[model samples]
Target: MSSSLPSEKALVPFVSVENMMRLVHHIGIETMLAELADFIEADFLRWERFDKTPRVASHSREGVIELMPTSDGEIYSFKYVNGHPKNMAQGLQTVTALGLLAEVSTGYPVLLTEMTLLTALRTAATSAMVARRLAPKGARTMAMIGNGAQAEFQALAMKAVCGIDHVRLFDIDPLATAKAARNLAGKGLTVTSCTSSQAATEGAQIITTCTADKQLATILTDNMIGAGVHINAIGGDCPGKTELHRDILKRADTFVEYPPQTRIEGEIQQMDPDYPVTEFWQVLTGQAEGRRDNSQITLFDSVGFAIEDFSALRYVRSKLDATGLYQELDIIADPDDPRDLFGMLQRAK
Candidate 1:
């Protein structure tokens, strides 16, 4: 049934990463991440309520690009994030991103924002949200295996959401680890630079792998991982890329964002097609168990799902609306006559 509603022709804003950083500074990163994590967890518990899809990836010799799109009956959102590890060599970010949010009712765009920074924030928030459910109690220390642009966000999110106060940081590039430590110095966490993945996991209850390697590198071996540790495997999100040894998956009870997507992109891809792994949403909703025992190892085989981006965009849209810190662009056509779909081009000329 169609009901009479006000025809509100409103233009939303486009926010850049710099503008987002200003907003983050005003709202505080901890608050932003905490709120974002709340949104993610809330959405996760209602997993069946969302319209989810696997991200579409475009691959190149240097790296890969991805488009993640999702909807929840009312709102539609999508993010464009590129992963070019070689971009860092040219002084550019390894992953650059932007996204759009639209109203499903009218198909009108609500907001467009740069997601390079927001992606890092959302990734960290998602990881922390999963850790809260899967990690052992009193989990204060974390081992960050890859210290890149995402390292600081992961460290801060762990501190903010999971109560992790100590981080043992490691990177093949000493400079990367140093940069992460410097960024996290006064963030109320004790940061340590470790020589190897084993050293980093020494006393850490949660180990996060955010490396950028494109190969099936085993950042966490079964020997280095201890019981009751929660592994946030983020880098092995693409096909052919992995961070944990296959043996580690056998030892730990693994959880994932989406079973079908993660089966292809996550570390579980190494295992047989019939390998058993639980969907994180199942645990969040009490349909499945998390951290079965104190001595059990838990792994979050994260592949950076579309739902995470959906939550992030929803949070960003709210903040941008509240602060009035965005610009509107005519990316969508609005014809004077509803039937004149092709008139936009003529009118522009």
Candidate 2:
């Protein structure tokens, strides 16, 4: 009777950054971005379908670590990411991450993949997704305020998603700007390095603030922003971190991913608790409006959300399954007999 039970084994897939990049290259960045946008929009329309929660954040004197988890009744996903701005001074990336995908039905993991690269990809993807709905038509120029690891991804996503062909770049570190410009060369866009934030914002249709500072640094002042400009605020995602001046938020018709979480992490945190801001999902679903007038300023206060990670994980899983680019692992255990869980451990010894 015991022998008739199932084998004490389970299969899961493990993927690496190299494999993930191969998958991305095969599928083409434009196609992947389009599909991810579709998934995000679909998920947004069915907002009630997900079990949402704010991320668990662990703060340190040097930086902050976060775990973002979410489920949709069947699939569960979570990302382990850390943000250490000062680490770059020591030659480490400002942000590093990894994530897991699981089957909720049996609590089994499906994939474990490094997210350092994926995080950059998804953050850029999400920024572009929001910009599509909020930015004014015929927008071509973008001001990228931060020239760190995320700068290239943001620039690529904008080009693929928003038809942006020129990027005006600025960073506190000239070398960082040079690195971004070097990465973006021959990507069909003109990259200009600027010395000041005000210089970068001039004549730009969209402004993206992805600075990697843990302090309350204001990258964009109120007077620097112009009408019909769409601001993608990405860096100010935790308590004590912000990029935009409070007055810029006061004039713009601000949009955020999730209000409850954004109030705590987005640039809106500087404003009152009752500050009126529209959820970008609402704009996607047509439940609310975006960019009422051509001259109106639009702000997307992006604090990398769990749903974006969910969409990213879903896309990666689908690609891996279709291409067989992942390796299977024994991440879960099954006992040959019911109530023999302890015996299985003994058998291994």
Best of the candidates, lDDT: 1
TM-score of 2: 0.95
Model 2 alpha-carbon miss at residue 15, Å: 1.2
Candidate 1, 82-147: lDDT as tens digits: 988788889988899999889999998888899989989999999999999889999999999999
TM-score of 1: 0.94
TM-score of each: 0.94, 0.95
* Error of model 1, residue 83, in angstroms: 1.4
Q: What tens digits encode model 2's per-residue C-alpha lDDT throughout 56-164?
A: 9999999889999998888999999999989988989888888999889988787888888888888888888888878889889999999988898888888898899
- Top candidate when judged by TM-score against the true structure: 2
After best superposition, candidate 2 residue 292: deviation in angstroms? 0.9
C-alpha lDDT (0 to 100) for residue 43 of candidate 1: 88
lDDT of all predictions: 0.88, 0.87
Question: What value does the lDDT take at residue 159 in candidate 2?
Answer: 89
True lDDT of residue 205, candidate 2 = 91
